[model samples]
Each structure stands twice: as structure tokens, then as C-alpha cells.
Target chain A: MPVPAHHPVDILRFNTCGSVDDGKSTLIGRLLYDSKNLMEDQIEALERSADITGGGQINLANLTDGLRAEREQGITIDVAYRYFATPKRKFIVADTPGHVQYTRNMVTGASISNLSVVLVDARQGVIEQSRRHTCIASLLRIPHLAIAVNKMDLVDWSEERFIEIRDQFEEFLPRLDMKDVKFIPLSALTGDNVVEPSSKTPWFTGPTLLGHLESVHIGSDWNLNGFRLPVQWVNRPNNPTDPRLHDFRGFSGQIAGGIVKAGQKVMVLPSGLISRVKEIWTYDGPVPEAFCPQSITLLLEDDIDVSRGDMIIGPDNLPGQSTELHAKVCWMHQRPLQRGRKYFLKHTTQTVQAVVTEIEDRINVSTFEPEPDAPELALNDIGEIRLKTAKPLIFDGYAINRLTGSFILIEQGTHATVAAGMLFPPTEAVKPEYTDFSI
Target chain B: MNSYHLDHLQYLETDAIHVMREVAAEFERPAILFSGGKDSICLLRLAEKAFRPSDIPMPLLNIETGHEFPELIGFRDRRAKELGAKLIVRTVEDVLARGLATAAPGEVSRNRLQIPALLGAIEEFRFDCCVGGARRDEEKARAKERFFSFRDSFGQWDPKNQRPEIWNLYNARLNAGENMRVFPLSNWTEVDVWEYVRKEKLEVPGIYFSHERECFRRGGQWLPIPPPHAGAGQPDPYAGARPKPAEKHAKLVVRVRTIADMISTGMIESRADSVDDIIAEIAAARVTERGTRADDKSSEAAMEDRKKAGYF
Candidate 1:
């Protein structure tokens, strides 16, 4: 197997949501098919299971329906992941169910996704399910939004219908904290403006779905201004035969931001001891420099002490070091997240004991407003909370670097991951101390 | 030095490496489950990268079915030697001798018998975490798996009550008699595994490629001929004695679609003899990789049911 030389270094994770009949599966199937990513055996399997739909023609939904029950029910029971790659980029699509009951699945998909594509049937045009998905996307703070106006062919490619839905979304978009939102009116079923330009929608001049994905400026998406590498392993090849590697010691991790090259001065978080990059090793071979998201083993020039769970940082651009954290979290477990509950706080490679100090407020999804003084966060509820960790963690705001700024709450007894949290700026940002202040 | 913020791929990679390191750090005795398959092979590569410079910190564990393709076993032994990692081989036959697993009088496949052997090995070694190469996209039950999947004292996976994985945060907290099944490639798909293997130029078993072999037809599939019992009642025996007059069998030329045990594995007629051909074959495939696994063909929730019972 020849690995494509140009691996898409920048990954764009996106989730799709819509009502049962909104053609979400068809759209994903079309995107994958148009991209030439489907294999022959997959097609054969689809043909084999085509009888489940009874329409005789292949049900595009089957492409994502991996479970037998799902195939029988013709519904996406759980989140099914689909992958496709183009010459320019690779996509990991999370095809989540659109039903209200499966909102947790949608959140699970959207949590890591950079973009959210909320499909709406042109005939129905922004129904309650559409609102719910958009709200979830907004709550999750997905940076990009593509309001795919599907089934345009059924509307005879009417511009009025497209504009009506676009306007409807615009009214709700202002209330959300989305940084980038684009509305594309096209049909996902007939392959209109999904992979290629559609002749029917000549009036729409924007790029097709594929074009937008390829051209989207993801370079600035990472918080490169700050460097954060949560140490995953301590590389020590204690092998005497490999003399060169015998003395070789490095804190191995993927560079989470900013340019990291050989000979650059770096520091370990909390310790603040400076060191230099000895060598950067990737699966391909050694490279002079590496950037965000590329998995590479780094050999430090100096043997400054380091271990797993320790963070390596740029000497000058350091993250906030704190033991108390304020964050917005989405509770995922059936047990509500409450104050004084002890749970495991997993941040990066480190897992430490933590307790919820307080639940500040809960956001009402329908109105996009926060309810102050919320007592507890139930499953699928997004709320602001404070936590006290057993040890100090070096981190940036979740808005800055998602990798270093997020943490999960695990139930003490069950070891269940109960909540997903994005950290806000530390409360102790400013402080002063003086011995003679009393005098 | 150029400073680039971490992207999704880097995040996923770091996360996986971190998980591997955690398994090494937390478990007093940890071993990677190596099946000589592509996913496990990629895991071997990751394990190398995780604790490299130093030898892989843990041993490579293989539960031999005594029915695997010869090429796969040979490749498994060779790769373990090449990597300089300790290989621990546990067999179903041993378990049967110890009365841990029982076999049906005429049945050939010991796939179900693997669970007890694996659990026995875990207890024998007292391994806290068993790093596997299972990916979420392989099956429905897998899709619901967490990065740190918890197994109770009985080694059962509760899919409905799985731990929440937020960001790259993984909870590896376990109590006495509990174990963790960590999948570093939980987010990776089958294509991703192949692409990574191809990209890394990683070595895999020869059976992955198309090859000519003597086979017999059963249930609309071609079963390999090594296991003489597989041809027991058939009329035509390609190599051994012919069956009774009433029985039916045909000597056919075929190639393996996906390699499994000799008795249960199925073959697809293909001229794809090279890596590129396989990639092309997979790219155009609609049926999943597990479609050829006879064990999964039993039911839609077959994989899930098995996984809940601690089948890797």
C-alpha cells in the first residue's frame, strides 16, 4: 500500500444533522461517491442489502447504517463514522441521527468537529429539528457552519425558497456565537452543487460543497501563537547497541501549535526549564521543522527532566498555570453533574482527581440564553461550572487551543466520562503580593 | 522554529500516543494484542514509536487459534523477532486441555473459545490494560466504544453505560479486578489503517495480498483446504481421500478475500495480486471488512454481543 505523499495534515471534523427525511445520509453518500472514495466491496454490500429498502435501488442511507437494527429500521441508531479523501484534503464525516432522542449522539459527534453541516429539506425549510441541531452546533462552538439547503431539485431550484431558508437561518445565527457561517442552497440527493457546480443554480455564485471544504482557511484555526505539547511518553531506548540513541532522551508528543524546529529554545510547563529541539522524528523520516497536529517524536537537545503528563511549551509564550478552573461543560452521563462530586479530571495526558466547586449557570437551548444559578447539569445540558483539581494544570482558554484547554469529568465509582468541559480564562489572571503592605 | 497550533490529526495522534504511554505507565504488566492483522501491525508501529530508543516496554500477546493461515503465523513470528519484542503465544488447545473451553463434537472453529483463553491469559499475566487494535468504524458495537473502555471483573463491556471521552482526555482509572481495553486507533477507520500502513511502508502478512490456493465451496464461499476436517464429509477431496458417494465437493481455484482461520475464512475470486490492486479493490468496496468474518455473519449484533462478552 502506497500512502499518499500529500497527507491532509489539517483535518476538518464535521457533523451532519437533520430530520429523518431530510436526506442527510444521501448527502454524505453523494459526497463520498462524488469524491471517488468508495471501494468496490462497499458497493457490493450496498447492493446485497438493497432489499432492506424495498425500493430496489440502493438506499444511500445504508452507506452509514452499520447496525442490523438500523438497516431494518431505516434509521441511524448511533453515530456512524465515514471517511473520504481528495487530493487536497481528507474528511472524517460523523453521520449522526437527527431525532431529538439522539441529541447526545449529535453532541458526541459535534464535540470534536470544527464544522457542522445542518441539512434542511427545502420543502420543510427550517423545522424544529433544524433549530435543535443549529442550537447544538452553536452550544458546541463549532467555528464553521454550512446550512445545506437540500432537496432544491424538488423546489424546482427556486431562488425564493432558498432565500427564505437562508433568511430564516440568518435570524437565528445572530443569537449564536458562530464565527463563520455559510449558506449554500443545493440538493444533496441529485448531486447539485455538492461536489461540482450545478447548472440549475446558475444564480448562486458561491463555491460548491467540495470547493468550500478545500479552500476553507484552516491555517489560522490552530492556536499557534502559543505552544503546548502534552507529553504522552518519555522516550528512552535504553538499548546499548544503539549508541547514538543510548544518550538520546526526548519528551515525545505531537506539536499542538506554533513552529517547532530543531535548535529552538523550549521550556517544560510548571518547571520552566529551557531546552532545545535535538531532532524531530516522524514516520516518514527526520524533518527540519514541524507544526501543529503532525505526530512526531521530538528529541530534546538537553536532558532536562520530563515525563508523560508534563507539558512542553515555548519559553516565551506560556499558558496560564492554575489549580482552579472555570469552564462550560456539557454533561453526558445520566447522572447529573453537581457540586462537591469527586471525579477524575482528564486534561491532555494527565488524569487527576477533581471536584466540582459550583454550577454557575445553564443555557436554555431554545432561547440561547443562560439561566443563572442553575443547581445541577443533567444529561445533555450545557452549563458554566467551576472545578478544583488535585494538581495545577498548564492550559490556555478553550477558545485559544482546544487541545490544551479541554477536560473531561469521570464518575468516581463507574469511571464513566460524565461531562465534557471547555475551560474559560483562569480567575487568578492578576495577582500581587507584598510583605510590607500592612505597614 | 516555526510554531504551529495543533490540528485535528496531530491531536488524534498525540492522543493515541498518550493512551499508549498511559497503558505502559499504569499497568504493572501490559501487553499489546497482536493478531498479525493490519490494525494490530499499525499498533505495533505505534508501540515502537511510543517507547522507542527503548525497546517496546511490553510483550506482544497472540492467542493462536491453531487454525490461522500459515503465512499469518509465519509473519507474526518474523515481525516479533524483527522488532526485538517478547512474544507470548497462548493457544485454545491448552485451554481445552485445562477444561476452560469445550468444543462441539463436529465443530471446527474455535473463535468463541478465544474469550476464555484471553481472559485466562489476562489473569495469568495480571495485565491491567490490554491494548488492542480495534477501530470504532469496524462494527456498530465498536462505534460506541470509548478510548478507555472499561471491563468489569468478569471482563464485560457495557455499551449503554460507556465512559464519555471529551477532547483528548481519557480516563484510565481502574479498580481491583477491573481492566481497561485501550484502542489507540479508536477514531481511525479501516481505510485510514491501510493508508497509514502504505504510507509508513509497514510490513504485514503475505496472505493480505491475493494468492492462488486449493479451496472447497461451502455456503456460497470458498473455504481453504489445509484443515482436513473442513472437507470431512465432502465427496471430492482435493488432496486427501474422496468422500462417500452421496456427499458432494468440488476442487476449485480461488483466492482469499480476507484472511482468517483455514476452516472458516472465505475467499473472493480476484486477480488483484499487488498492494495497489488491493487498495483499488478496497476503495471500490461497499461491503465492510468484517463481512468476510464468518463469526459476524451469525447476526447483526454478533460482533457487539461477542465484544460485550470480552471478545477482541
Candidate 2:
């Protein structure tokens, strides 16, 4: 009867990135403040905090920099996530630190974000940190990018100043593969054009930051071209009271791509066995259809031992399954990522023993160029590398789907996530499943 | 196709389910840290959705401070039985009895002792991952936590050195002595929880809704002092403060915002009779749900310190 209900409004996951002094936190604080999302106690805590600035004004950055060290040091060292919703959309903002040295944390925040907001101070137009953050957003393949040229109030809301920053971003925007990029000029300190359009800036006309955030076109962000469901668990309740729960064996996973219907032809990866969906089940009840991002338990018509780590996909467009993978990785550890280092590679629900076969090259974040002859990737280094796994991984190119394309490296000894990787298009792009002429 | 969209609450439910499944697939021994709160109640429904035809892969664990509400304990047992899941409980009193945890001389709340009781349970049961219901929006320290948060061999969390969790690929690898605290509700907010509860028609304790109760004001919060509070030495927070009874008429209709211990839960004087009313109140309330929490009131770094010592 519940029908695995669907909401009218879409949910958007985005992140805010800027240099240390670029007012990234202030911008976020203003968004929360203007949206009435901040709680009174949180504001009271802010007012009571001793970390107020010289000018005082209830230091809005205190809303995010909640850690004691960050508050004392006046710099955000890690990624902090904030949530707020309007009538139009629900938003999850991963406010990542923009100290170029902490780029690894930026990558972590960007991996799951659908959009990225890169703030730039109007005084220092398009600095190296801005370029680095924009490059990182592009590298992570976040679908949307919003460039907020902040401190417009300080510059007297000059249209020339706003256009100068916009042109600077436009110069570098072509080199990257950003599809949807929007530029908004505003002052985070004065709350000029963050939530509501400011009357002061009559020369420049653009949606306010919050307005753009609420109306962004993110429906196409998910991969609808192909179907992918990486099985995370096997749901077998086997309840004695109810016959349905008693023997209902459902393969559970979040649909990573496309739509799945009750009778669609699907194939389980690694096994290569085809099956038809018997029923799509949710906690509320069975649904006729399910799609990408919906975690559902499936009752296959002919179950041939499907479990966690296996993938259920639309047989028409199957993902590649290879023991060896060429991937672009962002090294996140102190010890340099070099060839022949064995680590635990976690891709989706699967974890396998993987050894770095080769370190190809590193990408320079500032210029967006690849550097050859890199012996090893140091901490926070973005590099392309090859890996050989103990088992085959079912995945797509990161450009296709972030859920299936992304993975993280866990150092075998310390068990720390050492790298975030995106699958590089292999030389042999046509996968084994596609080689079959017989449909 | 129905345009392939889930409501925000449903999306959160799906995300939490995926986290649970990942933990189930990866961890050697995993458990859900149940506190009988709304978050954990949502988690029970998720755990059921995750592994319904079979038994839940892990047991439900609770680190009791020995001062929890009787209603919570009863609801916990009943719900655990309803789901046919194992409920493993370890009390701070037991830890104190065994001399593993010592209380500060005048400490009334055993909130700090909960860390040891929890870590001791992990060590005793060899649980590699304990799924908690902590949301990022709850507190500042919690905002920086990963869905699969790592705890080192010392049973401590180093907030500075957290692993870079990218996307849905959670690194659940751990050493023999180490364990991971998985938060399935990391992305869920308070409003989403209430919406999901109302949609699923899930059962929570009666305390969540409006109820008449005898309460007292301590540090500007209405705390429901249970019957055993009359002769407590250092176990009652009001021992030194001498918590005053709100003028007899002050025994107004109130509801528990968060289900902490009877000593720590800050009651909101409300007439929220239903889930919709609760949602409306939460939307309009100026104070955060955790702001009413007595345990996190000490200082700005209380949650961080408690987390470092491995408190859920």
C-alpha cells in the first residue's frame, strides 16, 4: 500500500571550496543563516564563542569550523558536511577546506558531490587556489559548478570587477570538461546576493546563489543509459510468522545506474548468468519498478547464487570486468604511492588485494598538465596508475557513473584509505561481455 | 518508469540501507548500536529491509549508562524480539563493578563511562564494526565524521587523521584490535527521521510524543527525574545543583526530543500529539535537538573529547 513512496522534489548534493581566507565558510554560514537553517543554540554558541574577529559581527565562520583546533587556528583542516532544505530541493553541502595542501580532503568531498561551488575573492581575482579547486571539481567529474565571485560589496558592486573575475574563469573553463558552469557575483560578508538578490547590484543580473542551488538541473546527473546494481547484501529475512518473509530471498543493493523493472532482463557480473527480475521490494512493500540510487531488495526469477560484491546489470550494456585496471588516482597518504605496493582495494561493495603495477604520470593541479617520469606519487598527488587485482571488478568509466567508477585504497597494514581512484578508459575498451556477437 | 525519483526521506533510507549492507558484507563481526531513539528506530526498519528473509547479520548492541529510561529498555527488548534479533547490552554499572571504568568523584552522569562500556563490549565480542545512528548535523564533531569512521587499536578516534572516504566505496579494513564505527544515518537529518517514521508507520516509545510527566528544570532544561533519583549520591546531575521542581503547574505536557538517559534527556514542553506536530515543532524550533542534550553541555569540545575516547 505504501508503494515505496517518491517525493516531489529532487535532492542535490554539492560542496563549497575556496582558499583559506576566501570566505568559503562565511559563504556557507551566510547560506545557512539566510535560509533560517541554523538553530538558535548554534547561533547562541557562535555569539558566545571567544573566536570573534576584530570587527566582531558574530564571526559567521564559527558555524562550520566547529573543531577546537580549527577554531583556535582559524583554518578548516578537514571536510565538514552541512544539510538544509527548501521547498524546491534538499541539499547536502560538503564544505571542504581549500588550503591547496589539503587537496586530498577536497577530493574526498568531491567524490560523491553532484555539484561544486568554488568561491573566489574579488580582490584577488582567479588565484592559484581557485584554479586548483576548479581543476579538482573537473577531475572529480562533478556535474555542476558554481563560481561565486565574493566581496562584491567591498568593490562597490562594480560590474567591471564581476566581469573581470568571470572572464578569468571563462579563460580556464574551456581546458576542463565542465558541462554546466554558472557564475554569481556576491558578498558573503554583507549577504548581498547569497540567498536573495541584492538591490545594490543592478548592473549584473543572475540567480542568487541559493536560487541557483535550488533550481540546478541535476536530473540527468545519474547514468540512465545503462543499468548497474552492485549487490551489497543478500536480504533473506526467513521469518517464521509470515510466509513471504519466510522464504523471500532478495538480492539487495543500491541501483547504481538506469532503471530496473519487474521483468527486465538482467545479468549478474562475475557469474555471467542472466536472470529476470521477479519482484522489486522496498520496506514499504513491493514496487513495480526501481531505478538508480534506490536501495531495493530484488527477487530474481532464476537465482543462481547472487551475493554481495556481484553486480546486477541490464544485459544490453554490461560494464567491464577486468583483473587489471588502469585508473587515475589521488594519493591521500604520507608514504608515496609507488609501483609494486600491495594494498586492499575497495571498489563499491567489493574489497580485493591489489598491487600497484605501475605509476604512469602525475597531473599538475595548477596548470592541468600531466608530468611524465614520476617515480612515485607523494601525498596529495594526483596521478595515473595501473593496478592488478586478485579478482575482477565490475565497473564503468568514472565519466559514466560516479558510484560504479570510483574506489578507495586501504593500506593493508594500517588499514587507512590511502587513495581515491577513478577508472581510466583501458586500451582494450570493448569489454568481454560486449565481444559476444550473440544477443 | 515513474521518472526514477525518491523523496528525500526515501533517498536517505536507501543510503542508510546501502551503508548497512556494506558493513554486513565487509565486517567480520558487526552490531547496531541501539539506543531506542528515533534514529535507531529508523535503523531497525533499515536493517530489516537490508536482510529481511534471513536473520540480521549482526546483533543489536547497547552500552547502558545504568540510567536509561525504563520505557526505552522495554521498547528495545520488544522491538528486538519482534525482529528476532539478538540484543547485547553492557552496563556502566557492570564496568564499574569490574573496576574497568572509574567515575569522577562528583560525576552524576555516567555518560563518560559509556565509552569504556562500549569499547569493552567491542573488545569482549570482537566486533569489528558498530553501526551507530549519529547524523552529521547533530554536532560539530559529528559533522566531520565519515560514514565508516575508523577507531585505532587504542579504542580512540584521531579526528585529525581520518581516512579519506570517497564516494560509496567505504574502506572497512581493520586490524585485530581496531574497530570501525559506521554511521548509517550520517546523511539523515532529524526531520527526515520523523518523516520516515510517519510514512512507515514505525513504532517508537510513547515518550517521543506528547505525554504528561513530572519534570524539573536544571540548567534551563526540563529533565524528567525518574523515581530512583531521591537518594542518589553522584548519579544524579541535580545532586549539587539541587534541581528545582518546576512550579506544580509547570508539570506541563512535554515530549522527549531525544531519548537519552532519564537524567540526560532534555524534555521540551510541547503539545506535539503526533508525528506531523513533531515535524512542525522541529521545523520552527530555534534550538537544535542536541542543544537539549545534557551530556554535550560541558564545553565546545565535549563531543570531540567523547568521540576521541570512543563514545557513540
Choose the strongest candidate by DockQ.
2
DockQ of each: 0.39, 0.60
- In terms of docking quality, how is candidate 1 classified? acceptable
TM-score of chain B of each: 0.88, 0.94
Q: Write one digit per residue (lDDT tens) for candidate 1, span A278-366.
A: 78876556789877665567888877888877887765455788888999888877779888989888888788889899999998876
Give residue B168's error in model 2 in angstroms: 0.3
- Kindly report which residue stretches of model 2 are placed more than 4 angstroms away from their true locations once superposed: A1-7, A50-56, A236-248, A426-439, B228-249
Whole-model alpha-carbon lDDT for candidate 2: 0.85
lDDT over C-alpha atoms for residue A99 of model 1: 69
Interface RMSD list for the candidates: 4.5, 4.7
Tell me the deviation in Å of residue B290 in model 1.
Answer: 3.8
Per model, how many backbone clashes are there? 29, 9
